[model samples]
Target: MSTNYPKPAVRRLKVYAFDPQASVTLATAMANDYVIELPWEQRWEAPLEKGPVNDYVEVIDIDPAAGLFYAPVDLDDAWLRDGGLEPSEGRPQFHQQMVFAVVMRTIRAFERALGRVVLWARDERLSSAELPPGAIERNFTRRLRIYPHALREANAYYSPDKRALLFGYFKPPESAADVQASWVFTCLSQDVIAHETTHAILHGMRQRSIDPSHVDARAFHEGFADIVALLQHFSMAPVVRQLLAASHGSLREPGLLTGLGEQFGRAIGRSKSLRYALEALGDRARTHQGSAESIAAAIAKLRETTEPHARGGFLVAAVFDAFVTIYERRSEDLLRLARPGLVPGNGLSPDLVERLTQEAAKAADQVLRMCVRALDYLPPIGMTFGEYLRAIITADTDLVRDDPLHYRVAFVEAFKRWGITVPGCISMAPDSLLWDSPRPEEYPALIARANGTPEGETPPQARMDPDDALAWWFADMLKRLQFDVAFDQADDGLGERSAESEEQASSCKVTYTRRDYRSGPAGGRNLRDLAMRVVTHNQRAIHQWLEQCTTDRHDWERLLGVKLTPACARVADVNAPAALRSISGGTDPDAVPNVEVHSARISRRTGPDGSEMHMLIAQIVQRRRAYFDPEEQKAADSGDKGAIGALRWKSPDFWFRGGATLHIDLRDGRLLRVLRKRIDDDARLARERAFRSGDMIAATAAVTGNPREPFAFIHRGS
Candidate 1:
């Protein structure tokens, strides 16, 4: 019944020194006392020749004398040891920092998991830009934030295929080299730095899990990062002290540590709370910006619309809930840690910080592992919440081999609360394509098969229950199905969320087609999804053709789905002022005005390798292709209108076997840069990779109904 916890592995940590003597550090007398949290065998294997270019983060040793510390080298003993070597009496050491606070360790573990090397701050190229018109000119570059400057002016990039982390925030690591230049990102918010860099890691290691195509995945990506940043405050002794003092143990109270970014925006002049937005939403949820209704309602109408990250969003939800649990528990415990002696005059004590921090970090690591473990339940491409649970149960069974009771009990317990019931998917193998099995300590299944279809391949006969279809497409059910109190089977609990329903899906059906010989492999979702998109496209086209603007908010809601109700007829103020606040009561007033219109209310997920570009066009009718200024990018970026060079997927010759090697051609405004490439491999590997790519985004795929034949789908960008 209890966990037979494995003996802790003794880790031999080799801390690479960043000082003038970039070698001599660490106490020789000390045993390998550090815990090897992840087994070395669990580390991802990468060919030595293709060494981690972006796997490990590059760190700049903060020269304490100058007072600017962008980064401390990741493996430095000074950063890892308690009390470090700093002579300061009360100042905390690096080991004392929160688990996420140990930016170096975060980089190190991520690199091992992803098999890439990170280019730390010391490896960046910097250049100053002369003022463009309307640019807020400033000489105090040190005060500027990191990402805006780093992304625009810097050279670093996060590459998924390469699994590398690159940073444009570098300065010289050599002592002899003088620190002459001033970089734009000298003053960075810890939360922003953590959140943005995490996107890179998630992209490389768990690409499908965070696909923006799915609402859960998109919200998860945003919300989980927020939780990570929020929990990170527990790691910093001073930050925790200030926060607790501000809240007086009321962690849930607004305008303190929990003030969702709006009021904090007033404090620092930023638009949103980089933290606590979810907690502020209260028991009753609203839009992300406190605008209209909850995003769930908006997402309901978008049932037919599949976001790239939709399937993976469930994992994000699981992570957020765990953080919610942990924080609530920790907040209750903080009462015990409070004292009259700590705050000097009040009751806050810094001494309690050490234990509280260690506990928080340990809890975070466990949460991280649990979330990582949950990825096994996730399909590499698009999946539904029901299917996601199936994946989780199957994955956990393999990882713990049923020896750990918590794996089963914990997951089943956690999911049921969120309306996520466990499915009958437990497996010993990690997947059919790979021989590898799941690991409790290590992550498997980060990558999705090119094809969205599962290798199980065997399809289940449709019992023809609405619950069956609703299992996968609940969002659509919420949109289309109508239930009245008078006639609806309320006792059946046969609503959208329930797996049992009185109504059956008529207009839509999902079919997973791979070959002529193989049919109905669990009645795969390809057909169901395709039907939805077809309807959506037609609906959109018809609405646009109508040429009549809506008088109210819900005017077009019915047009989005089958159900039309009083809610659908409600009018919205077309000329109403911009509601920058989310329904959840967060605000982002200072957001760059040029950013594209993402509905602040709802989060949308996408397919695997979730695309940053949302544009999807049947074919741009516009002729005499025009080269316009940067302002037109939103059209292309949103995946709606014609962006240049979107035909790569359509071009079978260029995109077929092994597809074009992609590079960024910023030389012009194009998002995709490419060197045409083709690869030849053994038959099996080829089929698998082909399926993976084609199903995810348009590329070469096995012609449905033909195993031997492969066809090219239009690549969005070439």
Candidate 2:
């Protein structure tokens, strides 16, 4: 290796490696120039003795010894992956070491093909004799590509065999830093750069996409990178001295205040490093996400709702939490490995960073690979709260097989309580080199998808038959209430359609007896349990409040605060007021639906038709609908509207549907009353009004025509 006018070229091929320089630094604290200092005990054995690079990847020419490297520039079309990699006390040193591990793994993959050392360096400023023609690079302080929309670069291409990762950022050079961020190395602070580049290299080794649609995806992206980047700071001497002094000249259990950024913070007379944080918080670490409590709340939710950061932003928060644990744990692990009772601020040799970085690199390498593999099966679009739970389950399902010791079991099962299930596609079998599962891809059950889409699969929809739709909604609510009482959990997995069949599952059953109604005027009933669940309930609540609204001759006021004419809440009593009678049809029965006659659970028989029906009954609800069509809306907004069709809820009109004939099922038929009620007494006489879906009601069996004869219970299906 000669340091001449021109640097020797280093072939860029991905490979596997064991950096001896790192090992020496870890085993001893000797001032070996080659052996860099490591803060954590990072020592990992390489998995493959060797591997080869295939297509979708090629060796780029670059000189490592002379500090110059050449690679292709095709990042503009690269897709960003939300690979979920994080550091933990049980694993790598922290964020910085994790980054190094990923980078080293990537470089080794390249080395296997190109057979040379790899160096991450920005483009040289001066024209060198060995420099290629038109090799201009914009630094992170200068540029970060342009138009960073996920749509433009939504698909990343990687070839493990090729040992190449093809991607780019939307970092267009707008101002100085925007331009500077363009260079892969310059886009991040030194630590952040090392961390981000590690992501690139890791992508080439095992292709994956970090979920971008969810908070966890974004957080993991930043957190894991931060951990990796920070650990690398220890590898440099100048930075190490600054870190040690700030740490009060110690290392064991020392907080990050010892790092260079902390010293800078101290120089400015602040408890924390604001400048460094401002610079690092954007794309790498989001630890300063407004308030620590908010971040903790998110983390707690992640833990409670999903396993090992499986759902919500838990996956994202897990990475940072893992970093904290890993940093403290590695510091402790180091004490056990060498010093017995080392205290914080007791500075170790600077070379220790290289050791920690290498060890961290090795630990990071394996975990990241696991993350990459998990991404292939995740949903391509919108991530709901449920999806997050599944993400963690699917991710660690494999990790459980090889490294269960390091990966906690209780840590994972925590998600199951939140309704997360293992993805069937991801089985115990070693997946293809590409790591794909036979995904039973399912989309959410939306009203629009009732007809099914290109996938040729959708939930069965019974269309919007006003009578049927109203009935169905009522039935659904009853079923939900029944299910909630039975299961006692919100997401009991009852509403979720099966991935394969796309059919709704029932944890509880509710059969409708009857329905009847008449158009009086829009009125509302209190739906207390409703707002807790269902989207339509929210709309209904809004409309209910508007019914009580009242107003003056010039300007009317609604009962619940909205203003309108007397027609808003028209009492169906014809004798009350002129407007009331005009709208309510001749003094509609001043009726409070009271069960005058109780029905007995008598013998019920099946008809020729498979559909089961029940005794006569009535149901009610305040139904309102808001429909939108472009043409109609435009005309209405422009004051061109004369008479617009409005969907309004008509109460006082009872809804009745489905009736059944009674038969004695009891063989020795005397009087078998599975359920009973009194009917003879005028005070006891009852007229049963079928309960609407939201109505909390009770029922009993009875004989229809004869008031004296109570319906008998019969033996049915065993």
Give candidate 2's error at residue 357 in angstroms. 5.1
What are the lDDT figures for the candidates, one per model?
Answer: 0.30, 0.27
Task: Give the poorly placed runs of model 1, Cα more than 4 Å off.
Answer: 1-55, 59-103, 108-187, 206-231, 245-250, 254-272, 275-277, 281-318, 326-362, 383-718
C-alpha TM-scores of all predictions: 0.35, 0.29
Looking at candidate 2, what is the lDDT of residue 286? 35
Q: Write the per-residue lDDT of candidate 1 for residues 1-718, one digit (tens) a residue.
A: 9889663353223211111111111321121112212222222221111110111322222333345433322322435433223211122222112112234345553443222232221111222134332122121111111122222222322323222222233232234122222331211224434444555544433324333223344434444444444444443343444444444433444332332222212222233332343343245233232223433343343343333233223333444444545644654566554643455546444555445545545554544544443432343333345444444454334334432224334444334434443334453222321212312112111111111233233243422232222222223223341111111222322234223322322222221123211224432222212322233323233222222332321322211111112222222221111111111100112210110111101111122243322211111010011112323323332333344345521221211111111111112212121111112112422333344444433222233322211111110110
lDDT of 2 by residue, 393-473 (tens): 444443243433333232233223222223443522222112222111221222223233422353346343322322332
